[model samples]
Target: MVKQQQGAGHSAEASALGFYYQAFFALLTLMRQDTDNAAVGIEQLDDVDLKVDGHNLLYQLKHSTSDAPPVISLKSKALWKTVKVWVDILPDLTLSETTLHLVTVAKLGLDSPLIALTNLEAERTELVEAMVEEAQRVLDARAAASKMGKALPHADRVDGCSAFLSLTDTERLNLMRRTVIQPGSAAVGAIEDNVAGHLKLLPPEQRPAVAMRLVEWWDRQIIYSLCGKRERVIARGELQHQISAIVSDIEHDKLVPDFEIASPPRDYQPDGMLARQIQLVDGKTSDFSKAIREEWKAREQRSKWLNGSPAMAVTINDYDLVLEEHWSDRHSQMVEECAELDQKGKCQSGLEIMRWTHENAPSTVRPIAQGWGAAYYIRGSYQVLAIDLKVGWHSDYAKLLGDAE
Candidate 1:
């Protein structure tokens, strides 16, 4: 009994490994079937596991940790059912291009009765008769004993068995010709590695985002499988759109960044290259030094004006506008303009920036606002690497000048 139990465990493990190989094959199939101009998606399903270009490809992947038995033949219950289904669906002219494949990690079953046939077309009638005979033999032995009822539905048993027996010689030949038998197991890991290489072949700028999108796509595939949703194929383009939509939704609902200000202000330094150039080109008492001093003094005066009132902090109501202004214009000019406004008390609150942002903010610019914080500041020198709105504004504007209240 213990020996028998051990054998069963080994069998179960092999079965799991085979299932894993099948899934990997499906993923690799999707990668192969994906095209830039067309959309396609893959789902775990029946004999036809992949659907593309309006043609269905039935992928029958079989794998084993060790070599399978010698002479593995296509004479099993699986083969018969596949044959029956294709026969029943033969009348559907739209599905004429559907192809059947028998992929296995094991050698062909040489001893199986179907192995002797040399010419499938010439011996088509004989082949059908033999297949029907084999099917009935299994049904008589297994179905009557109720041992394989779950696998062989009682309702479709007569219909399917009859269909296979009735298929003409030409029909049998067609089915036989369409069938593809790959008897050797493929390198599973190589499949994924090849896919990774393909992804890397994409444009360098797009590779990173596309890689992330593939991850999201894989995750969604797992979730869908877990939910028992079977065999739903989609265009790759459509899948990409779905993944992007998911990312957008996640950003909108869950990725809202927080803004907080510290009282003493954060320690920072000016752009090192600019400072070094200034030190090397202009002495401390030179005109450059005087200009630097004036810029510092202006920044100091503006900071005081903004942070002056113990009762209030300067606020920019139009963060988007302020962000846009800083991005589109020179930082020094923006600082000068803001300083002039502060002198007039118009810059007491960020209401102007906020108002401007509200009026001009486009959907394209909304993603940049995700990183804004209470510590936002502008510097004439390279004190802080600010977001340049001219290009893709990858940086966020710190909104530190005022309290949220």
Candidate 2:
């Protein structure tokens, strides 16, 4: 019993890997073909492994973990199970338009009965007759076991074989005619190679980076669809747009900003020098919260940028210097305008300076890269400087924070 449980656990893990392969295979299909209206769905429409709407194709993906997987022959359970699924849904499909596909990593033997299904020119009448004979043999064996008061271990396979026998001769021939077997399909690790192959138009050195970005984005999109966060159908146009965006970023030397909509933790409280500087000028609670959120996003994005090429590090340093200069100029202007004002009036003027900086500073500063327009990155960078005492909002921030001039 313990051994059986371990085997079941291993099977479940392999099944999960199979689902991932299915998603990758779908992505590969989208990349290889040019069909504007085609959309792909996972685990929908009679619970087929994959359903490509617009193309009228349903796919069953069988993945194995072994380096030397067994052959998919006439009596292979995976083949019959896939056939059984299609047979059950045959009533709802248009025989002339719909195609059923069984995609597996297992190799097909020279004498495999399903070989005829792979070839459009092959005569399928003989194949249909042979399937009927095999189905009868399976049913007879189950009958023999029942007469001996014993249960067959694979009752599901027996049921699937029986289901095939119930179809009429015309239905059987039409079903066999539309079925396709794609043996030796790409495994989990090799799917990456297949994806890169479809990107031959790209420069050889850029293919890997582009493939990685596309695959990562595809995985996230699949997860979102599965989790009900978005529509389940993945349109080909959506994938193409993402590819274009990624390529554009790489070519233009731009950083794609992440965490743009991210928020601080619910229990987070504004603290430290940045918050103190805001408070010194009578900044409101909303101002403090926005400042903290923007600072967090900028710091996170900057850290990620620094992890890249040395050129990116230099870009960030230069951008920070630009922000500091902007703050310095603004601070000097605020001091001059409020020179004759009393303490309360000076504080009011300082608040106005902060408001203007937040509203207009992003537009004045030079972006780190061409076509990159994440204003939060600019706003957050200024807050980051204030946190480190390199810049601040109020005119007397240095003295208020007890910093050396």
Candidate 3:
């Protein structure tokens, strides 16, 4: 067993590789394309990485029990290196739809699978083989349909995540117009027009020979959608975990440039596309942007709460319990310090003031050193009560964080 504590050690990038690998199979299957079945084996995580439709992907797969974190910071810092590498690959090839993505997937180990087959190896040495065969079948079906002039619609890429062009001519052209496919973009033409050329400019030495290797890979491998038919439930769960982690980071002041959660996440519609798009998103970027914003707000609020209150308190008036808090230690300390300055004769200056909260906290909260103690804030013709003070002896940060009732 590993250290099972909050903010535990990192996991490996390989955890996500399975999902990305699945995605590759999905892509191949979707394309109605065919290729060789064997891994070219230039090396794993060395001389070669996986490229699909010209996009380079780093797939990190981890088991549930795995205890390594993927190289998120390393990849972010080394982006320029990858860019230079991409520059080396595009010159002699067509990389019109290329992009780079770093993916990490956490998966269940092979001891349990939905379909249990005896003699199936625990190492899953045959799983990839089976997946490839299934992918080919899916591709063949697609090919047969396409030949009959019946093709399925492709999904649009989620922005800030990945970009994908549709198999249909109209959508593909529109996507092409909206994006530049080359490495020389931003330096040359407009952002949209230049992306394509930017990709095409990759150095010839790194380019895959389109006539054989690219086609062969396409034939041999297949990609399945990142989302399965059961994706809605999985998406909700994954999204929640993702959102919660981000919220925690913001609360800790760890997320830079700030994180905010917009009211909704995406502009979804009932039976429209994403059922909750509008309710879940706001502004230009929608869910991706909106979610982070709202989460930031909640983090800020929590920081504010934690600052003003303590885990517990001893109080008069029957020792009333101030159950939940929403402030941070630093901010609350500053608030108390300002109050102390006010109590003493250390008068006026802008530094003497923080953001003006209500002149009074609720009555249940009596001021103590924790700073989160409550009092009454004036309401029109009345006073409003807050949750800042504790009258009783019970305290739980879990409840404070909303995990407990």
Candidate 4:
């Protein structure tokens, strides 16, 4: 075995990085249906050890010689510096359009008070699980939000978002009773309010359509994301994050961010993209993050029914999605990649993403929508990525349901 050297615990650090590489590979396999983007290629960017799709991931594997676990920090400041420096330089080496990220894998997984691979206590596993879930929460939400606004005539956007957000908070204590979401409860409340306010403002003409679009998007795009949210909860085991202002539409056509009254401190730096990603990681956690997404969709659905035609309003909140600030890194990555393949340059929008997910994803991913064809959508997370989606009703009701379902 390689011994620990004086150079920033390179041995242990590299081992942790290796584990991240494996996990990420598995995640990509699940993410990429055709295995193209999933074919990650690593290159030495000035010998600093840059991963192909290894940004904003979190994780720490552990092994003990005799007693318990390791500490959070792996080694010396130089080691931490190595990571920080790589993060700073990665942007320069990344694909001009793709967002580069810094994935800091913690080697503090084993022998600690909580969380373990084998005989670890449930509390420990849950604690570590909490951290992992928080990060995933960020990734999922970010992906959705990055594709909002420019949505087509989806029917479920508002309702799904509304219900999911509401349910998330209502059950936070239960989901994270063994973790730290309590301290951030106030933040959860703020997010719910923010989502509610924005969803309420969806174009009065298109509420139900958007709500349904939210649910459909989730089924297709996120159902088997980079890291499936199945039973296991492990970090990138890393967290995908981004910083976003919970802006509101006032008298003017301005999207004014509302951080002064939220849990996240308004002083967060937003100049650089990386800084924003980190900020989002802290803001949109899983405990409340997933719930918020579902709520936004639901809200859109409700809006459609309340304001528009009653029965004809057409509820589709079952498929819409909101941007998770925390997981914005992966979220942004996927959206942009899909946007590029959208084939229709500059046509990226809510409708576009919805159309793509519905048309491309397996039948299980299809969402409920009204009208005859696909929909167009804009960024639901950040202000950049957008895409398309297929829509309408099928003639063969029984066969279509069986096949689709």
Best by lDDT: 2
Root-mean-square deviation per candidate: 18.0, 6.4, 22.6, 27.9
Write the residue-wise lDDT of candidate 2 on 71-168 in tens digits. 88777777677678878888788878777777878888998677898876678999999889888888898888989999864565676787899999
Question: lDDT tens digits, residues 130-235, model 3?
Answer: 4234334444565677788996321111111111111233432322232211111011012222222222433433222221223222223322111232311112
lDDT of 4 by residue, 183-300 (tens): 0011111322322333454554343443333222322222233345432321221221100111211212221211111232235322232222222223235413322333233334
Runs with alpha carbons beyond 4 Å of true place in candidate 2: 1-16, 34-39, 46-55, 223-238, 259-310, 320-367, 373-405
The lDDT values for all models are 0.44, 0.76, 0.27, 0.29
- Candidate 1, residue 32: the lDDT equals 64
| Model 1 score (lDDT) | 0.44
Poorest 10 consecutive residues by lDDT, candidate 4: 180-189
Q: In model 1, state the lDDT of residue 405.
A: 10
Error of model 4, residue 234, in angstroms:
24
Better by lDDT, candidate 3 or 2? 2
TM-score of each: 0.41, 0.68, 0.20, 0.17
Model 4: lDDT of residue 309: 45
**Candidate 3 local lDDT, residue 56:** 36
